[model samples]
Target: MGRIPGRLPFFLETFAQSSIKSHGSRIHPERFNSTSNKVPDMKAHQTREVIFSGIQPTGVPHIGNYVGALQNWIRLQELKKEGKKEMDLYYSIVGLHAITLPRDPLQLKKERFEMMCVLLAIGLDPAHCCLFNQDQVPAHSEMAWILNCIAPVGRLNRMTTWKSQIASSKNSNSLSEVDDSMLHLGLLAYPVLQSADILLYKSTQVPVGEDQIQHLELTKVLAKALNKQTKNKNLFPLPQGIYTRQSKILNLRNPTMKMSKSNPSDLTKILITDTPEEIRKKIKSAVTDSIESIRYDPENRPGISNLIDIYQSISGQELEQVQRRFQDKSVVDLKSELIELLIEHFRPFNAEFSRLVNSREDVEKIYLAGSQKAAAVANLTLSQVKKHIGLD
Candidate 1:
């Protein structure tokens, strides 16, 4: 989740502008003979880091979600505030991508608003970063279509997420049990769109969970592919992945599975806006071992390890530190302490979320302003892409 602090050279807009023109079709593709244009030599020329991340507008994000991803975002924002790292951060409510899965129209609308609210409630500064809705920006879909033309279908077939979904639905682990007929085009080509999301902003870094590393890899592959195809190395930055330590947070009820909004059981995860009482009840009912000892054994005792993980995440302590603190403690006592920690952390956050939920108009303005900021960057990238491909 943490990156070693260092400065990257700031991207010069003029450099990119001129670089694109130099390789344009007007000069004749044959004349674009340069060692730098070679795929292997396409190193990151731009120093200005663009960090892009998105969350689906599916349901309320759980505590696991916050600790694993959102918390890291806050750290990045703080780092930005300190002027330790110069970067452009873009966060989005990926409403367009959400529709790849089935959704009720009305609920989708509500979830988008709520998701934005949660972003603000979690302390993402609109002034410091571009926070917006993906559907509000046309460039995402436009760029996705353009990228899909060059993206290999065979590579898309190898994508793990879509196949895993099909596997889960059919109750099989083998991908051989599934085929193209089982997946929609949107689902099949979702990685192409995800690549567009990152490339649209020229994102140099993407904050993602381990499950999403493949998607980011696809983004890099597409970037390299495009550079090779267009003979323009500066066209897009191949985004690097920021992998966090606690990226895959387990479910409370079933430690074997991820803490998912789709889990059907509310007790499986703790929402940010959950009341103190609700938090207490949920943690109290959290599935723990009958052995009744507080230890950090994940393989044999996933549930206890999960609770320990949550406790350590919220407390900002190491597992050894947490274990030492609760060495001889019972599960009931552990759950009680976790309840208190969560309530203390989320009290103010819940207030902000409630306030934003009430002031829907203000939330809309924040989203609009963010969308405009994102669109500005996206427009420039898309325009250059179009120009290079002779679409303009």
Candidate 2:
């Protein structure tokens, strides 16, 4: 298919309209179950499951981002297309979350648009997923504020991410040694905001990394608390975690650390849009052990093991199979194959990404339309929340 125009195309609009019609009716589950409960008699309980997830717009996504999250999202979309599952998927570029740390506004604005383009290039159809920016929908912040009021301070204090951030900032090994004054409210209350993001659309499932499980657990707590406080059995469904097969992709430079944009070295991670030469250069320089033979022993040979893991993950082969396949191969040989594999894997996506980049207007239209679609669902949930909390 040719690239879409600057405006949302007619077919996509028609698809959205049809989707709304099909899911127009809303049903609320009755009978609260504090411990465990029976099935609700309401037909609404059979509504298509909602899947929500958000990613920070730091910069272009890296290979780690692809393997750990983006690929899994594509899989989910494929499953939905094949009738293997029925779902309402919402993926957001979390511009708000990006600001919790220091950032250049102009750079951030650029990154957000590029992030949208990247998502589309990766095969996320506007008709299949509501892809938008969090800042575009004001309800995200509004809902976050409402949830913040009920979130326990003690719970936020115990959050390991907050403590770790503080510890890192102070260069301290002890959590207690880090001063509480160094922490910001946004950083501390991020879990509540994350809950708001998920519950705002009544998301039933969330795809998250293993590190974010604590925040998702807090989301469940807030959902249960809201249900109890409002005397509503099913005002919100506790969002469940849909963990990806590869939850963390380690940095190529340092196998012990998770790949991150914050890492100073560009060679440590592979960007989705990285040119063939860049991919070859980075993979060639990737850290590996002195041992000549290829093996997957993470405990002892983390660097080589990380490379093996990346190969298996991208190739969709079992770890044991990959290990056996490369047991006799030299480290240099393995690196060469990995470089070629990545280049081939990203060839089509890079072309699509280039098209989207040149057509920024079309990307914006897609994002705007996605925000509208997301708001329709979010407003419904927010309206019910307001009524229950006497805000209406």
Candidate 3:
């Protein structure tokens, strides 16, 4: 069973100060309100753009994951390198969230390390941005326990992820078949935990796909709820969702569904580490109509359209441009070109990924260092939250 709900841990008091000073916590200094003894409006006053996002550690991510989110993360880092000096990025391998459902113990450890490697290989520089495992920081769960007190069950029930998960777990598509007695508390309330993850970092910008926008909305709601209890009403920044055109990538085997690891058939998705031969085989097997032509018609020709989407997302070309370029090419031609593109792109990155994964000692140290950076900022926020919630 999980730890008792609603009680913030006492360990944070001992840990917060050291972490803050060591990790470069940049919380803006605020003048105290002499009359009310409360912080001033911080909503309009955050000094830095705290950007946060996370990925589940399921091993090497597929091509869809890269195109959908990881690619955008690199873009964000590059933009910051170009001198967005005030922006800070935090990317976590959400191990804790991944285990909400059952997982093999040994595989979890392996996947956690591999996921970290994937981030590094994809150009998420730990020297600049914070990269760590969510489970490494105690304060995330501590803050989550605090958030749970005010989060509404109705809101959680409304979350489509939660709804679908509960349904799938019971092997039933109907809501009536879902038995409340068997409801997993962690699975149901993980969104609240996610809110804690965002608010802990004072994240003002969150990179999210279309499916996750509602979860971010729930974060804003919980932040508002907490701020309402304080005189300032600005303890947390309402983070906005960042979306990319390539956020929703469909499967190769079935164009109707998003490319996901949960799909039993390996042909449905292409992993970043797959060999040239494997990439070629999967692309060739990708479902398409007998039109013998390529177009971006997602409505009637989802199969060919899905391939076009993948090409445009990877090549950074507009839909019209991609269509024009492929207007005369056959389906076989498109598949061949996409296969070569993927193979050439992943060759160097895959080497780096393998090296990082194999060098367990170095990777562990890097992971710990990133965790410390994240913890320093998180613990500082928890310190203030303690004062507001009477944990002090």
What C-alpha lDDT values do all the predictions have?
0.76, 0.76, 0.75
lDDT of 1 by residue, 88-108 (tens): 788889988898877899999
Best candidate (score: lDDT): 1
Candidate 3 residue pairs in clash (backbone atoms < 3 Å): none
What is the TM-score of candidate 2? Answer: 0.86
The all-Cα superposition gives candidate 2 an RMSD in Å to the true structure of 11.2
lDDT of 3 by residue, 233-288 (tens): 77887887765545366788878777776666789889988988999999999999
lDDT of 2 by residue, 12-74 (tens): 222211111112121111111121122222245228788888888989998888777777667
Model 2 regions lying over 4 Å from their true place: 1-46, 164-179
**Number of colliding residue pairs in model 2:** 0
TM-scores, one per candidate: 0.86, 0.86, 0.85
